[model samples]
Target: MRVLVAGATGVVGRALLPLLTSVGHEVTALSRTPRQGTVVADALDRSALHRAVREAAPDAVVHLLTAIPAEVNPRRLARDFALTNRLRTEGTRNLYEAARDAGATKVVAQGLAYAYDPEGEGPATEDAPLWRRPPRQFAPVLAALRELEERTTDAGGTVLRLGHLYGPGSSYAADGSFVRQVRAGKVPLVGGGGSVFSFTHAHDAATAVVAALDKPHTGPLNIVDDTPVPLRDWLPELARMLDAPAPKAAPAVLARMAVGGWGVAFMSKLRGADNARARLSLDWRPRYPVWREGFAAELNGTSDGTQG
Candidate 1:
């Protein structure tokens, strides 16, 4: 199979590209900055992206491009959310249009599994309602995800709703660009830190993306690990793995004042997602089932040697 991976330099994309190639697939990687074999394509530009897709003439296209800055900088996420929304909405639309025009058979793209409201059950399934009415600040992100999902899957494309990514290159690591501040004791946990979320290794997520290419299923699917960890538990465990001190707790009010609305929701809210559908449909399971084992491996820098 010939595959074209957008955002090929991204955390998941970087991992997925080599995985697909190792499996003997002809891979054409697309990114803004071209590498040895990568093509330069701006996903937001319809004509350019269309031409690139046409040139590659791939059997499948994996839309992994995201405007969200790496997780190390969660403090900046409020300002960046709008850009991410644009990437999810307009960028996704452009990718889907190009894929359809290029006669691609499969389109696999990334979605977030953590965006749903924490009002409902603990482990939300694909059928559960999204927090359509997010806080005024997050309204745009929720809107973009809704638009992206509708547009991608409308043409029989596949949507992989991934968990909070935490492996190398993601925001969850002590050395990750976004979350390093947390390790430096700059970012604090809000409220009681009771929010629960599912997570996946970047390589594990990439593997699922590759597996989905040949699967005969479509529509929304949760590509999460088997377990969801609560923030109260995760923060300490991650600190231990990174050899850093446990995050200091902040009063919810103080946190909201510091990081605004989205930070409060993320740090103190409760939400989890179920990936049973993906397991049944894709015939794939996550190498890392939860944050403890997988994050420990990542902190120990073992993920590089175990790409599969």
Candidate 2:
């Protein structure tokens, strides 16, 4: 299969390029700054993107761009949410249109698993309701996700809702970002820290994307690990792995004030997701099912130090 991957240098995209190649697929990586053979195109700029896709004439097109790096900064994080919202909405629209014009048969793109409502089921399935807290503020993001999924489904494409990403190139750094901040006693565990959250190693995420391409699954599939831990457990576990002091508990009132409503809620509520669909449909299983087994490896700059 000939595949055109936009944002091919991104976290997942970087890892995905190799997987697609390893399987004997001819891959064309698209980037804004074209490499030797990359097609220069911006997701926001429809004309350039259309031209690139038309030129590549790939059988499949993957949308993988997101405004990252701001995944930690408070202000920038909000901006990233808005920016990525556009990427999911406008970027997806552009890619789908371009892919259609290019005669691509399949389209696969990234979505989020943590967006599901954290209160309902013990482990929510793909059909669960999305997060509705601060409903007005997150309206655009939810709408965009819906639009992206709807379009993808309509085009016979697949949507993979990935969990909170960790490991290399993720915002949670080996020596900086959330991991470091918690280690240095800068971040306090919010609201007794009992929220259930899921995570995925970047490499696992990449592999899942590749698997979905080969499979015929459609609709949203959760690309998360089997283990979903509470903030209370994962935080201290991460601290221990990094040889840092455990986190101190912060008052829920204070935490809500500090990190805003959504942050506090996410840290203190349950948001687990089920991965049975992906596992069954795409023959995908996470290499690192839990953080304890792989946290140290990620800090050491490898995905479990056993990728073959």
lDDT of each: 0.80, 0.79
Question: Tens digit of lDDT per residue, candidate 2, span 132-240?
Answer: 6633445566677888888889889888888888766666757547776767877778888878888887788888888988888878899999988888988887777
TM-score of 1: 0.94
Worst 10 residues of 1 by lDDT: 69-78
287: Cα error in model 2, Å? 0.9
TM-score for each model: 0.94, 0.94
> Which segments of candidate 2 are over 4 A away from where they belong?
74-77, 134-137, 302-306
